[model samples]
Target: MPRRSYDHYCAASRALDVIGDRWSLLVVRELLSGPRRYSDLFADLPGISTDVLATRLKDLERDGILTRHRIGPRATSAYELTVDGAALRPVLDALSAWGTPALGERRPTDAVRAHWLALPLGRAIGEQIDKGTVTVRIGETVFHVVVDGAEITHQDGPAPGPAIDLVLDLATANAVANGTLALADAGPDAQWSS
Candidate 1:
């Protein structure tokens, strides 16, 4: 199916024409970390139908938001954001900040993924540090936030080298993300490792 557009001359409208779909930005969100296989994207995005996901990926690729490439010994296909697409980092950050307060509590119906908090939490941590790696552990899930100058990035798993280790529960993580709590206030309870 062809994309539906606002067809207006406005810049916002044109942008919307490209990324206005439901899963478009979310797909961008997942790709922000790094390249991911189709199955990886599907796994992280809970409710998206396979067909819808495929459509969004195709649209994004066509629009140059992301590109598909094959890698590894088996030549598995993966999708990654282009420079233009990565420019949406600030946009996603702003949206996450705006929406933080609305995330009061996790509802029973709400689906929670540990890695889903990576972006917002990384931003929270970014504000405190000049440059460092902070490994975060929330229950069984583990990930690291890397702060480089003004830019912050996170990976899905543990840090490779020595870094600060933050051991906290999901509640505290949400508090930090929503601005209710500061990283410094997380306290001596958190261990710092070499």
Candidate 2:
């Protein structure tokens, strides 16, 4: 490949030099979710075409952004991140946070809220919460579940008092609260809970 020249001020241009195309960053997003097979990338990123996905994968491999693994024939294989590729998590998170507000003021930053809000809801919840208060715990973070009309959410910084309505597990909680998964799906009996 031949090298081209551009001005130093174009940070976007420099960034693009490494991850310029739409497919590249999307591919990185997919990889960030963990190791995934070709079909997995396809299943999650339905917008990409097969030929285009293939080309992007090869280019990433050539550039050392990722490395491919093989597993017999059924599904080709999966892609795992190299150090350089994995380094973009914060960038992805920041980018997500940046775009979420575009949905407007009343609307929340879907990603962050889900994560922070779900910080308290988890699988260990006893068969029935003995107290009326909603409970939430995400690592060291915590919140009490709150309900407003038909919608449920949370409030926090301290232990919740009685009369709240919703509680959740941080990771699984976010998956449920954010629309990635459903209440039925978050059930202790759900496949993910196991």
Candidate 3:
């Protein structure tokens, strides 16, 4: 692929030049948490073909959005967002907020991932506290989110030591994301330990 372009002299066009491909932003979304093995990205990204995923990774690396590096003796490779890529947080936030209204009710065929709620939920949690680790559990999936100053990051599983713990389901998570519900008022089923 020669790489597609809008061929216009606009800032949006310039942005599209870097991330206009089908799975580009979603690839960025998966990487927002931290570095991920290619297999991890493939697994989280449900419907993407192997070829397309490989191509998106190459394109993002070529555009300086992310970098792939090998670690340890086994040389396990992982893809991580560059500074410029991590800066896409606000863009992703805006996009997530914009799309939240349309996420009304999960259909029978919908596939859900707990960490998919990381960005919006992280933002929500960030607003509630200045700095702290929050462990979020949605069913069996567990992840810990760290909020340090203005930055928020999350990873798979729980945060070590004493931290605030939150448990909620997909419906409530959506409500929080959509601003229809407050975290403090997550009802009897939702529990939090500080």
Estimate the TM-score of every prediction.
0.88, 0.51, 0.88
* Candidate 2 residue pairs in clash (backbone atoms < 3 Å): 119-137, 119-138, 120-136, 120-137, 120-168, 121-168, 121-169, 122-168, 122-169
Across 1-194, the per-residue lDDT of candidate 3 in tens digits comes to 79788999999999999988899999999988778999999999999999999999999999999999998799999999999999898788789878877877777887778788887888889988999999998888788889999888888788999999999987887677667888788797578887
Better of 2 and 3 by TM-score: 3
On the 0 to 100 scale, the lDDT of residue 151 in model 2 is: 31
Q: Over the full model, what C-alpha lDDT does candidate 1 score relative to the true structure?
A: 0.86
**Model 1: per-residue Cα lDDT over 1-194, one tens digit each:** 77798989999899899889999999999988788999999998999999999999999999999999999999999999999899988888788878988988678888777777888889878887889999999888898889998888777678887888888787777677667778778665455566
Error of 2 at 107 (Å): 14
lDDT of 2 at 24: 89
By lDDT, the candidates rank as: 3, 1, 2
Clashing pairs in 1: none
Model 1 misses residue 112 by how many Å?
1.0
